[model samples]
Target: MELWERKLKECFGSAVVDKPKAINNEMPGLPRYVSEYLLGFFCEGEITKENLKETNDYIHEHRIDAREKEVFKKDLLLKGSLKLIDKFKVKINLTKKKEDTIQMEIPSLGISDAKVSSDILQSNDRLLIDGLWGMGEIVYNEDNKQIQLEKFKPFQLSEIDLEELIEMREQFSSDQWLNIMVSTVGLNYENYNRRQKLILLSRLIPMVENNIFMMEFGRPGTGKTYAYENISSYSRVISGSQVTEAQLFYNLTTKQDGLLVQYDVLLFDEIDKIKKTGIDEKVKNKLYQYLASGKFDRGEVEKVSECGIMMVGNLPPGGFSEEELLERLLHSSITHSAFLDRLAGVVPGWELESLKDRRKAYTKHYGFAADYFSEIIHKLRKKNYNYILNRISLEGTTIRDADAINKIISGMIKLVYPNGELTDEELKEIVDIAISYRQFVINQNFMINKDPELKRTISYLIYE
Candidate 1:
């Protein structure tokens, strides 16, 4: 094992695992967190061939593919009852007057309207929200032709000590902690230089902070979407060209809250293509409003959410300047100065290396288990580090610019020094990166609009 891996294991113990070996390529449909949880449970200690085979066999038997829905249903009918591992959610049918209105959706088995007992619902309240992934037992009532969920056991980590996680930061130096974070996200720390690593870490600012609007555009296959998709279940990735205000904010017809209210982070991947589907002016206006102040109004409903927004896309392979790349890659609706100014930071994804060869880019060392790491990030969002901003001064920056820079600094501190501990030099380094990120947006806005007002210099000073 590597030195860093040994240190991580010594500190975190069972919370860490061999990240590369946690998933089997053959079992492709399961999410990274689910795969890691099962792997960690079955293949404890040194993962051997026997353990791997046993894990794979269990997954194959329990994981029901959409294509195998009919087969599983047939078996359930013959056996009178079935127990399987799947994600199931409860939907209360307000329209139904009967007591059997509490329905369960077993997504994997393609079964909707399965009756769920009130006891199960009380035990797993999460089922009413985004649902829970775990073992579920379903029995068929032949007379009524209804399926009932009798039992459930969630696989996700139910409770985490945020204080303990914060305390653990004291065990490593800043550099070592940075490397450990990089590895936690499944990247090989040794493969990236310091600057490149910072750029990668910037992708996580949204995860650690709330209502942070950011964008990253660069070459393809850079693992832009991989981290957001696999790192946490609280984040949702929308890749297609079309995005509606109703889907993002509130749906009037369904009277339901949208993605922004449901997740910690909403990542819009392939942003360049979103313009092709045509985002109308109304949607753009609503998006800008929400980005500015985490609140949106639709008809009679007005709600506030803390979900962060991240936009990511690929720049066509060429020698175009950064200004030209921004012009071509940004969605048409958000190209104006007003929309650009709301962004807290803009990551230069071009600086990061590609993940074309998984063997070369992915980490082989021990790192935090996916579910555990995700929970830590989710919990970190509740921490307030804006108080640290009082020690720094910004010159010649507008309110928006200062707010944007402060958020980045706060997020950086939260990620690196969650225990609220840092040196003067460390604070300076974080401030410099934060300013540069916000400056990139300012520079791009000036280049596109040629507005003299956007060209102001933003500098920061740390006060002892």
Candidate 2:
């Protein structure tokens, strides 16, 4: 164990300072001392400089144990040989307090039991969902917690199995609203867990609600393509630069009639590169109709109404302002046409480049779990999940463009949560995210409109 610890420190260098709680917390789940030791090293040493400094400062301020967590490593190897693995199993006993709140304990750890308020647990599940690897794998655990919370609490509980959960989700309440439901009522998982569920739900809900084509648009590394590529074997993502109408929907040239087949998802990477006449007329017309109605006629054969469409692309650097980003590109191409309307949803991409070290990698567990859920959600979609949103209300919801936006939100929720079981709180949050996205678009468009100064700019005038 000592040897392994030394090796890990050597591996990461000076960033591997002693932080006992993190070391102790991770020790049990790791199989060998080597893994735990390396984890500590990675957590400390490989961390970004800011994180390294922050954690170091935190350890010092808290007077945390600075001694090499080498003893914990030795205990791991020695205990493994003794077949005392049971000793390492952390028994997390959680008792229900108020409705949706919990009191948790693990006597063996000699720590005072703690309580999680209903508000805390009920906070947006996405908050819990993070890009971190292990943290995002807690959805199943959260699902389990839902059942336990209902059984133990002496309060009225909503009967929500995965089915009802789906029903609520189909409401299309709004990203913010759905986030709230998932956060408070939905089981809280880590970010990876949340992302997995979000990816699956995002794809599945649309199929269940409208079976209309959907596209995820954003810059690179946002996992837009990853979702279609890795989540389900049934889905396919192809480069927009290379795909032709025939290859995408129908291959009439082949003996098998070109395998003219509809798919669950047909994701287009680099949609901005799609060739068009006059940046709008011919190109926008073809793509727009196909996206909205799923109909397209090529040279020899025509394929109509066959698959869901997801288009992803990168916005130019400092591309117009946020509001103008999507609008500027669209207006430049075609000027507010049907192509924009056919889009069921648009995932807003974060602007700043995520710190390279802050980025996460796909793990075996995340991949498998996501794949499994994708199957489940796909199967469930066959059951018909759609709702109608006639009315919704939220506090302090004043806005410059309430009428049109509210209608869109309501319509989407109806599409998303068909059973009409969406809660008041869930509705509020979804509206928030939805409104934020719309605001982003509108504001960005305003900036682009004001860019008359760029009318003479070479790049602005150059057609893609």
Candidate 3:
């Protein structure tokens, strides 16, 4: 009976009609707008001239202004349509003409010539973004913007932090602009705020050719898995205990029974739980090498896909002193420095603590559409990693000295940067997290190895 409902029935007939009905009858009721978006998505390419006319009439019946109707239609055509699936949501995109208006002189199968429409293919929010641009755009003028954009190229790297992101957004009011522009590009604003936006941006910015960045943190219930489970159609999560290298690197071709194919993100849950003893060292080494350099060979077809390797793990028990935890980890069978170095970023998971009050978890507004953030991330990956880092570091401290201390601190510094790029201020923050993590590790190690360097320094341990 609604505008989108009529349009959907006209375009897709009983199929979509059943969908909403089924939602009400068998599942939770979807918001009207969300349902309408799904209806538009279902009949995306299948829309015909007759259906369009019906849809136009339905829009008028619903008092949808011609201008607004045009905008929504434009979004539908350009950005594909929004679909709701179990747990996750998907936004598909159609090819778009990047202009304010699109003029078609040729006649379609039935439509007449001289058809003019607005060019609204993708959500402005989901527009192809270079993460470095967001950071540099906030700091320098337009001239420097171009300079930074050109200097950075997408690659495997980490990013800066949430507090600094808030500061940047505060300094320039670009957060509002981002919300406006990016939403028009096809993202939902309800799913993100500046803090989470920055965190997601940092994790995704340097992701480039054959890149793998793993984030394993101590915070247990901050909804890290929730985002991956519900967002972006391009990703999937696999339990570490169940995964095999074949599933990760390649799948089997059922017909010939060889490896099938690879994916964009191979997220391994409980990575710390995998059985390491039985697997051959050769296979382990190969897996490590592939993750580090992004290469593997099978006769003539050298499969080189831009796959991102993400592993999430919780820190050991808190009862052990920081030094004890580190010592226990060191005594473990894991051995591979290159893999450790390739860790582009490390999120402080413990920061995302579970609310002591269970009622806080019941709020409707707590969860966000992960795909929206994922799409934003997909766009940020277009920018250069190093360039973004340099631009951000302009105001922050630079680690000219990457001593063991510096190297340790750099990981935290990278978390606050746009793409592992830090400013002096960002460096200080990074230095703090690094020092904390290092202190934890060092104290634990002292108990295991009796090393003096493991002692926490007055400067390293920040006193409140």
Candidate 4:
């Protein structure tokens, strides 16, 4: 075993899994976390053929395929009930006056009008929002021709020891910890250089920090959307879809909160296509306001959300100047200085190679199980690391720029130095990277709008 892999296993133990084995046995239509959860449960060390077969058999029996929805329904009817592991959500039918208006939706089974008990909904209120992955029993009620959700157990780690995680970080060097994290995200650390690895880690900033608006534009197949989609259930990805004010913010008719309020990170994948699908002007206005501040007002509803906004899309095929790249990649509605300034950082995804080109891009070594790693990241979000900013002073930056830089620096500190221990050189390196990220936005802003106010250089002095 490699040195880093041995260190990871020593530090994390059962919390780690063979990432490549998990990927190899990945079930179609299931997130990485779900599959890794099973792998970690069944296989403590290496994934043997016997254990793999058992895991695959369990998935085959529990997970319903899209094409087999009708078959499953018939079986449910004949058996009077069926149990499966799937995403279960509840939809409130306010228009209906009957008590049966609270309905359940099993997307995999194509059943939207299933019945659910008040007790179940009360305990798992998260189902009311975007729902959650869980093992649920559906009963076919002959008297009413209704499918009822009889029981449920959420498919997530109940709790994580945040202090234990922070203490474990002391066991590994900074480089080793970085490698472990990259592998946990299912990437081969050897395939990426130091800067490329840092960019990949930067993607987790939104997951760990609050109200961090960022964008990443690069070539297609660069795995830009991979982390958000597979890393945690706390984030939602909207790709190649039109976003409405009601769906993103709040629905006045249903009086239900939208994706922005429900998720920690709301990512817009293939963001360039969102423009073609057409977004409402009101949605854009509210989005801009929310990006600037975490609060938005719509009709009689005024609410605050700490959800971070992240946009990832592909740049045009041909190479262009930095100014043209920004103008072309960003939707015209949000290409102005106002919206650009709200972003904490802009990752140059073009610097990283596509996973398509690298055969060994996926890590074959052991790393934290996806469920455990996700829970760690979710818990990290509640932490306040802004105190790390006390060690630095900004020069020649507006209040917004400094704030953005501080957020990036704090986020990096949370990811790399969660124990709050760092040498002078380590702190300087993080500060430089943070400045460059914000400076990328500033340079593009000045070039596109030719605004002298946006052209100022951003530099920082480290306090001894």
> What's the TM-score of each model vs. the native?
0.95, 0.44, 0.46, 0.94
Residue-level lDDT of model 2, residues 1-464, one tens digit each, is: 23333433444343233333232332323222222233444353443556545544533332213262344334423443111111111112223344423332212222223333344345322112110111110011232332111111111112213454444343333443333322221122234343333442443333333234444455565455644553343455677545544455444453111112435556667766643323334444556656545566655656555455555677765644554556534435533423343444455544323213322232211011222333433444454212323344332222323432444354444434545555665555456545554444344433545543312211001011
Better of 2 and 3 by TM-score: 3
Regions of candidate 2 where Cα sits further than 4 Å from its true position = 1-219, 255-261, 274-284, 297-306, 318-320, 327-331, 334-336, 351-355, 358-371, 383-421, 435-464
- The candidate with the higher lDDT, 1 or 2, is 1
- For model 4 the local lDDT of residue 130 reads 71
TM-score of decoy 3 = 0.46
> How big is the positional error of residue 213 in model 2, measured in Å on the Cα after superposition?
5.1
lDDT of 1 by residue, 284-325 (tens): 888889888889898989999999988898877665587666
* TM-score ranking, high to low: 1, 4, 3, 2
lDDT (C-alpha) at residue 360 in model 3 = 41
Q: Model 4 over residues 1-464: C-alpha lDDT tens digits?
A: 68878877777788878888888877677888887887767665768999888878877898898899999989998999898989898888878778757878899888888888778898887898778888888899888888998888887677678898789888888888788888888898888888788888888889988899998888888789888888788899988647888889889897778888888898888887754654568988998889888999889999899899888888877675665777776666777888788878888888988787445888877788888888888788888765668879999999999988988888887888888778888889889988998998898888878888888998778887
Cα lDDT of model 3 by residue, 91-143, tens digit: 22223344312222111111111221122212221112111101100011233
Task: Give Cα-based local distance difference scores for all models.
Answer: 0.83, 0.38, 0.36, 0.83
Better by lDDT, candidate 3 or 2: 2
Ordered from best to worst lDDT, the candidate numbers read 4, 1, 2, 3
Q: Is candidate 1 or candidate 3 better by lDDT?
A: 1
